[model samples]
Target chain A: MQLEIKNLTFAYNKKEGNIVDNFNLKVKKGEVVALVGASGSGKSTVLRLTAGLEIPDSGEISIAGQTVAGDHKFRAAEKREVGMVFQDYALFPHLSVEKNIVFGIDHLSKDKRKSRVKELLKLVNLEGFEKRYPHQLSGGQQQRIALARTLAPGPELLLLDEPFSNLDAELKDKIRRELNEIIKKVGVTTILVSHDREDAEFMQAREILMN
Target chain B: MQLLKTLKKASPGWFLLTAGIIILLLIPNLNIIINLFGEAGENWEHVRDYLLINYFQNSLILVLATGLLTAFLGAGLAWIIAAYNFPGRDFLSWGLILPLAIPPYIGAYVYQGMFSYTGPLQTFLRNNFQLQLSQQYFDFMNIRGAIFIYTIFLFPYVFLMTKAFLSRQSASLLESSRLLGKSDSTIFFKIILPLSRGAVVAGSSLVMMEVLNDYGVVKYFGISTFTTAIFKSWFGMGDLPTSVRLAVMAMLVIFVVLFIEKLLRGGRKYSYSTSNIRPVSRRKLEGGRKIMAQIFTYGVFFFGFLLPTAQLLYWSFLSRGGGLMETLHFAFTSFLTGGGAAVLILTGAVIIATTARMSSNFVSNLLARITILGYSIPGAVIAVGVLLFMLQLDGVLSFLQMGFGIEANVVLSSTLVMLIFAYAVRFMGIAFNSVNSGYEKIGESYFEASRTLGKGVTETFFKIDLPMLKPALMSGFLLVFIEIMKELPLTMILRPFNFDTLATKAFEYASDEMIYRAADLSLVLIFFSTAAIYLITHHRRRKK
Candidate 1:
């Protein structure tokens, strides 16, 4: 799987380009791509464009050789097969762990979905936490569940935006290493977004300085 | 003596303030309960048997339908505005909340006037298509009609909350969902709605409370809700005890609704670090879909704000030629009266709220919450309670003055003072809420820093707190002032003889089934309200 972004740009108020000048980036198959920059350097915007979460002013985004967005033609986020973990670990607070994991796999057989959730829970070291709500879990545990939930649908690529930022400084290092190890074990193409240089160095197989 | 000394060691000033607030809030409840008890609690049985059930069913139906409609319209529009690049998306973003300026009852009145047999819609059809009036033809004065009108005005709460929620959502979530091969609609149901559910519920609860408290709409439409029944029990049958009991029942229902909503929110806390994320942009609507959405949005706006305002403007002109001067004079006098009352309310609220924030006393904090309890009680119930308490006070005063031959007139019940007092009680909640919201942001460290630099408490308040509080103070003032202008139940009961605010004046015309003149007054109330809302939102935008 290759994620190719070309000439991507975005503006906040339509006139002021928060990120301007054409840009290009690519993440090769089974590689971790880290986007590290200051707040408004268009790093998150690049991720948004690739995920089909946002359309670009004039750019093309191809995921696995399919043009998802370009020339005013766009695909919706659900059709993109790219899993996302938000900065706040935006777990469905209302749903239990099992339900949250199974949420994206509606097209799968019920038994298959259940077994997949079980497998992913074990992979994320949350095998016995299926009945727990998002709020009931510790930040580290929540992040793991968020990762498992994102990967449940077998997305070829996973995009994590500051996934460990909410955890305490004591837990951040441990969680970061754990996150990197799990993604590698699953052999999914991963993009880790962070403002911290250390996090980028630690997590990425290949890194891009987004600013 | 030790306990007494300890009590005295606590700030006497703070104690007095808390006591005053407690007495002010508690007086009405004590009086109402005593009166009900004296009357053998007849009202309790009546409410339990008849009014309780009637109001329960009516309020439930109104709340459920309006909630569903508000959620759909608000979330649907928000999703489009946030996710797609669409023409008119900008226009819809702000224009959608304009209906919030028009109160539900006022909106209902305007719509009823427009759709009634002699209204423009019927008049046009009758004259052009040769249609005649019949009982089977059309009726816009029922439960269904109330739901429609309430939905139009209340949907804005949902719209604003949902829009804010969608805007603040991390863009990466949507992108990841798409990468996983989920369709647009699937993401909306599985992700967007679930994430924003709390906000939607918060907005829906607000709408539900408003529906529960609505009297003018239900009464006019002949839907026998508890609020109307309570009013009738007091004013029509002269059963104050019964009315108080009914009010308590209504409060119980509201408390249950609020509790259920809280339970569903499930103590989940969402935290976002102060960092920039790329915002999702608006999408374009094309062809028939675009036209359909425009019509729907504009149609709601036309009926909700424009139609009512235009009708009122036309009537204002007509009424000017036909004694509109008298109406204008009355309106001005009412504004002055209410404005004076508002100043008093704002002063009391600021003083208490500021003190509560400054003090370390737990009792003072408890007293502050007690003071805001009057907010939960409806205006009519508070008026009744105040009247009874004042009447009792007069009796005691006369008894004490019997030797001097002094006569008593129950001065508190029949003067401008009492009206202002009731206004303060009814609207102090808004003032407290705004002031509290503003105060919470001013860190205690700032206060400590100021104090260590040799600033006194008063000096700190005047120099540091007051300037920071200007926006919230202004907002609180405007809310109380607008609410006073729109108040009907309390004003109708407590206002000195021959006095009328814009709300009561409008209600007079509306009660006569003459909506044209009332439309003018309703529009005036809405204009003032919209200006206040605009100022608050503008201030917020500036701060952002």
Candidate 2:
């Protein structure tokens, strides 16, 4: 599915200048795009807009020829076949790794849901880690679980907002390459946001400078 | 199969917590809607109007007085500590939290005990100066007195919160403003005060709620607050409808205060842009300013700490020859009951907080908020709600047994169940706040890690999360326990018939102008409260 946006302008507060000015972008099917900018440049805002987590002031967001967002138009994140892994990885702290990964699989059939969870766990290399709590895992493991959870529903597109941001420097580079390989193997259309030029290079995606 | 797999994978503790919360939200609540919103049918308007006029006015006045006094004392002292270095500043930084230990009613007893006619302060005056009876002394057995005492203890809520805010004050902004020819006082007004308004409002709103909840002080002082009025209308006038009307009105007042607090916060979440938290540079006091700083800090401590303790000590000596053992016995018994209630409340708080975290559903979040609504309602209102809820339970049981010979009765209402329920309803927020703060520290990935390892939600909560939350659990329990020890109004109205806790014991003596007799128990209460505060602060320091 092709994702397209036209003339997006958004401001956090009207009194403040626009964080995401009259911006534009387009992405082809199954393409990976890396959004890069300094803090407050609205790199994350663009990711939120694509995931239907936010609405642009006066812009058209069309996915596969259906206008998802524009003036007085919208679709929710859950319904847009898009999944997000937050920077801090907003996992449900109360759920186990398996339950967290399978959280979005509520729409799947019972057999299918179990099968999908098993597959995603294996894909994230968390095969024997299902019973461990988030605190039990290292930062890298948590990132993978976050990725697994976000990808469990088999979203048409995956959005990772600085997924490696919280990891230590020694681990960030390794995890970035590992995550990129997994996403490519899964063949999910993805947008990876990063401030580190090295991260963008490792992801091997076309760059979309937010500012 | 999916349910089983999910259960197998979820932590058992989380599962149990979820089940427990679901049950709590469902079972107790089926009746709250009826109790709070049941049609009076005939007396609705009468109740509403009385609530509108008398109860509303009393609650509003008390809130306003308490809020202003607390803010003035709280913020005033906070500024003193933040801006100027003084001899007592270091001591007062932690010492100020001591007043929070003494329940308002207990503070009232000490205040009334020392200053009341024929008491130590007045008695000493009369004897030393040879004054005639009723010649030259002031009385604190009224609303104004309650306000004075409440401000002393409640101000710390404002003071500490504002101090934390002031600690994060932009030094560069103040420095730049000073360079631009603004005076220190001018900079304080334009920069410091405006920035700290949110903290001040939040802290004062809490003080207002505590004022509303207090029944012991107002009742002993013969003050006619909405809380006391509710009690009078319910037990005194034997009119539940009128009492409920008053309660509904009191609830409205609380609602407005809460709404205003929320509005003050707006959508702005305040935190320092950077965490390089250097303490505000202390200014050197000169001339009378140095004396003023010493005097102000000492004065606050004098009224807030020393005077009350002195009164309690003097009274203890007076009571030394009379029923001292009995007072000790009563104090021990009350401590046990308060501890029991604290444990129950903390457990419920942990359950609720954990459940809200797990589901992260809108409903759970709203329910958690609703439970905390009791924080704003006065203790008497909670007592009335508990009473009405129990009364209805008895009524329902009696109705069900008409055909048979069995009597369905209000077993929970008249026993420890009522006390526990009331305590939980009243102070569960303390547990929730403390535990939630710690719970937030445990990242979501930890839970996910456990889940993928084949643990269920319930198992993770107990095996993983609960262990990590040990400090929070202990601190939360300590806080709620101390609060329960100091709780007066709810204990007064809701304790099993004839039960005399330390709070009530002191109130009983203070009621008859026998401050010395009440002093022994008051001191014990103070001792526990001070220890609790010290423990909490010490734990917090260790954490830092």
Candidate 3:
């Protein structure tokens, strides 16, 4: 299994009921799955737990057969080797498109980082947009760059949180198609958290209705 | 062992550095508390029995009167400019903040010189209008005049803070009130005031603290407040212990006021349910109301900034002799000291602000709040504690007498390092707040993304946060530099022998009744300060 969860339960506050309760899932290597649910149905929470951004109340999460969380042992997000694309595409506002894409690839040699940035930008179909700041780019362009940045440094698993939510209906179909193609081309085990179940079928991923 | 392990994994170097800085920062306040019960100076009984109550009464009255007046004028002006689009509103919005560039003490002397029988107002009445006026009517050397001087010069603190608050307030709040058939004044008095309590309290507390810290205005006007008494016991009566005790008393009073305000606020937090908030858009005013709004802001600006600055400009040119080079010389010294202290203080601010923003630990948050308490401390009070620390260190270095024939505690008498250290202690809050607000605007998503991208706390700060936080760093440095330049009490108390900054130099010229000679230095301070304030506000408006 590329990713596994056994009996995940979590809550933002104890006074309120659990946001994710007794959740279980698994994904094979190179698999792409969509966790589909309405708002507040814990679809995003499940993704966050698998990414090691949040720990469960009681559960185990293993990535690549390594027990990253549970049994009083929890690895941090960076050590878990999981990449998250935030809902708002939290691009570093001060960094250029090239710097942001190569932000996580500092361990590479200078020439390697330069080529890798060029490769990722080309993959996202934004090969000539590396010099612009985040504010200068459109919402759709920003989402593409954010994906390139996340994928620059290879991760064992990729988590996308409502990546198409910020786009208008007119542009959503195109961006979602592009993002789905890139995820498959990279062949990383991926989980896409969204409210739309049809997007799962459209992207040829197994659908897990969270609620 | 578990707790230790958790902490060990959580940015230990940054945590330890923050802890060390906070402990070092608290020493001055702790020293004052410790010495409150220490050996009494020789004049302790005289101060305690005959002078302390009068000092308390005078200081209390000044704080309360000035606090209320400034809050009224400031919040009133802020509401008018923020909520309504009146004539001259755009220019008045930034123009009103210029008054802060005029130090209150300088305002004191300028007003006195203007009101004196031989001064401008009387001379103008006698010469231009051919009408003689009674001297008693124009007297601005009393406590009432002190309150006036302080309110006019310091109200911008309240204005800027409250205006920022009102500018971001969701428009739905006012729309709902308007739907209930409430008039604008009714909505303002009943809704806006309650919602703005936090900002108003924050701004007014600064005003009251400024009034408490003042020594120049009170001394020059012959008013016997707590600050004047601190100076008298130290320099006049040669009683250091009594002077320290008075400072501690002033510090206690300020903390008590802050405590009372917090208690009154209780736990009522005004939080928005949605992140997407539409800001309050201004309503247009026409006819008579438009005329009044224009008059109010411009009138305040005219008196608070224009009248005093123009008068000083005329006097400086009239009195110009061989002081141009001397003025530039002291200005350079002022810039260097202010710049050095600002750099040191902002560095500390960044450390603490980043730790507070990134972590949710109780101890770190408590430490950040304690650091802000330094702002409430009067400068004369900080001077006592800082001077005491410097003296102790001087004594430690005195053991160097083993090698040379130097005296034991002579180091405190001629060191700018001591003065700069005190400046850091007194002004850390200003820089901390600036950096903190900047962090609030950028939010934490970018930070979390950096962490997930395999960067540690320090690395992420250097590579990501620092570049984004450049504007905040610039404004914080400018504000701190300007404040250190205008500072009077601390400079007077802690400066090395024979050294003078623009503030002390201007004050000296005024003390000898040479108001004209003081003008050159005073205008030099105002010119730079006014330019900085304009730049800060201009940048803020552009960002908005």
Highest lDDT: give the candidate number: 3
Compared with the true structure, what per-residue lDDT tens digits does model 1 show for residues B1-544? 2232224123346457756865776787677766655654555675676567777888778877887787787787677667765566666677777888886777777777777877787898899999777844368788788888888888888888888888888887898898899988899999888888888887777777777767778877889876787788877877777787776666777777778778767754665675677666445677887787777777777876788778667766766656566567767977798789888887777777766764444644674667666666667677878887777776777777785776653455678878888877777877877787777865443343233223345655665677667778887888788778777777777788887877888877887877667866776678778887788667777878
DockQ of 3: 0.44
Docking class of 2: incorrect
In candidate 2 the C-alpha lDDT for residue B144 amounts to 74
Descending-TM-score candidate ranking: 3, 2, 1
- Cα error, candidate 3, residue B486 (Å): 0.8
Q: Residue B248, candidate 1: how far off, in angstroms?
A: 1.9
True contacts kept of each: 0.00, 0.00, 0.52
Candidate 1 docks with a DockQ of: 0.01
For all predicted structures, in order, the TM-scores are: 0.66, 0.72, 0.93
Q: Report the lDDT tens digits of candidate 1 across residue range A58-166.
A: 7778888888877666665556787887776656544688876776675689899889989999999887898988889988988898788788878867888777678
Residue-level lDDT tens digits of model 2 in B1-544: 2222222223356557656644543333334435656556344576566544665666677788889878778887888888887677788888887778777877877766566675676787688997655623357776677788788888899998899888778676666787899987787778777778899998999899988878887887778778888777766767766666667667778888888888876854667778775667877678788898788888888888887787677667866648778777988887898888887777887877776665424545675676666676777777777776776676777777765777554356778787778777778777888888778877564554344333455666776688778889889988888888888878878888888888888888878877777777788888988898888878877877
After superposing candidate 2, which stretches have Cα over 4 Å from the reference?
A: A1-194, A200-211, B1-58, B131-137, B259-287, B359-365, B395-410, B449-455
Question: What tens-digit string does per-residue lDDT give for candidate 2 at A1-211?
Answer: 4778898877655678888887888888889899988878899888877776555677788776788888577664445777777787766555678777766666578888788878988888879777777767787888888889888767777778887778888877788778988988998888888887677778888887766
TM-score of chain B of each: 0.87, 0.87, 0.95
**What ranking emerges by lDDT with the best candidate at the front?**
3, 2, 1
